[model samples]
Target: MADPRGLATLPPIRGRVQQAAPLAPFTWFRVGGPAEWLVRPADMDDLLLLLRDLPDQVPLAVIGAASNLIIRDGGVRGVVLRLAGKGFGDIVLEDDGIIAGAAALDAVVAEHAAAAGLAGLEFLSGIPGAVGGAVAMNAGAYGAEVKDVLDWAEVATPRGLLRLTAAEFGFAYRKAVLPTRGVVARARFRARPGQPAAIAVRMAEIRAAREATQPVRARTGGSTFKNPPGEKAWALVDVAGCRGLVRGGAQVSEKHTNFLLNLGSATAADIEGLGEEVRARVLASSGITLEWEIQRIGEVMP
Candidate 1:
């Protein structure tokens, strides 16, 4: 069946727009149906215009690296805006800070910061998403988070572009209270000076640690569930005996209990079903209901 939503209804913009764009290729999970509309804005100005001119009735969603997302099989039914790396991937080094574009990979940003002798952002090397996603979720690993170094972030809201401070974001464990319709454009981080060699060594250590503990080479989402307060999620999952548990082609990662893997030919339903099963078992066994760390979007197939 042809899509009922017409592209002609959208405002003209200097970017690529597609109707019924396949979303699976954009995510780590590699499962899901097409997006109703996918818009990749050429630059910040282009993005702003789209946001400002887009009708109030039309919903909009912004995706960064798509590292920590799960688009449902039924697909997303709105404009999915992505910032193209060519225009939104700059990394600028300041005397005491680093400014990174929303599309800049987190690992690349860490590497750039290290080359500039910045110390505090080494933790970003271990995170898989881009800077915007990191800021949106307060992404963290190995004892540090985006909130620790983020001085401010530039966001495009329906009203206009604005610079928001870390405090204003109301950051919490694995989350940030950003505007519902805002799109993170770029971010500034404050870092102290250190020897480049030392920063590189720290990043290397982080990489080695993650490689050893995570299913880095598999088709998987990073972490499935958030750790309950004072409790490690992986340990709880292990205790619940969900390690290596399989449903259809999805399995709890044998290497890491919290990581869910799609062992080839897994549907989005299979993976999501397996996760819910884990949560149910964990809740029954430990009485601590786990919250999801990875963001699941779109609708389920009828």
Candidate 2:
């Protein structure tokens, strides 16, 4: 399929937008088709111009590090917005807080904050997504979530840019109350003083734990399902005899039953279908339906 508008003709703004961009390279799964148009804006102003000028009917999808995403086989239509190095990857240290660009890697932010003697964000050291995705999904590890430390955020809505206070985000378990069509530009998190060496030790521990319990090196979309109240999704999955289960090249991670792995040659459908099977099996076995925590998007190929 060809892009009718030919994105290259849009006359060189500060940003570079591409046509028919392969999405696999951008996601953790390493599977999926191309994006109709992929735009990497240079900065907030550039992004704003692209967004405002985009036709109302043209759909928009923003992705961060793509650690928890699975773009389908047929690809994404309209515009797929991704922030580039200069545009949205800065990590700044403020007196009592850290302001991170939405595209900054969670681990990078954690490392920089720890170096600056900022404590309480060590949990982010283990998460492998961008700041925006972390906020959107309330990404967490070791019992701490993004919502817990966030003081406020810089967001861009359809109407205009605004600073959103912590309370305004209406943070909840695994969710943020962002506007339906809004984009997170940056976030501010407050932290306390702590020894940099001590924070590094904590971060190392988190890394080791993740390595031992998860398929961190494998092509996976992190945790597959949210835990049901009073019961862990992994426990139920193991009880249902789903650990090490495989459907084609997709398998339930033997290290962590909550994770689904793409064994080199898996397709998006294979991964998604396996996830669905896991949900069904858990529901049938434990009478509790499992909800996917991973973000599944794009289209299925015929």
Candidate 2 residue-wise lDDT at 206: 99
Q: For candidate 2, lDDT tens digit of each residue in 12-80?
A: 557878889999999999999899988888899887777666666677898889999999999998789
lDDT of 1: 0.90
lDDT of 2 at 26: 90
TM-score of 2: 0.95
Compose the digit string of candidate 1's lDDT tens values, residues 14-88.
899998999998889899888889999899889889888887777777788888888889999879999976779
Count of steric clashes across candidates, in order: 0, 0
- For candidate 2, list the clashing residue pairs, or say none: none
Predictions in order: lDDT: 0.90, 0.87
Residue 221 in model 1: lDDT: 82
In model 2, where do residues sit more than 4 Å from their true spots? 1-12
TM-score for each of the candidates: 0.97, 0.95
Kindly state the number of residue pairs that clash in model 2.
Answer: 0
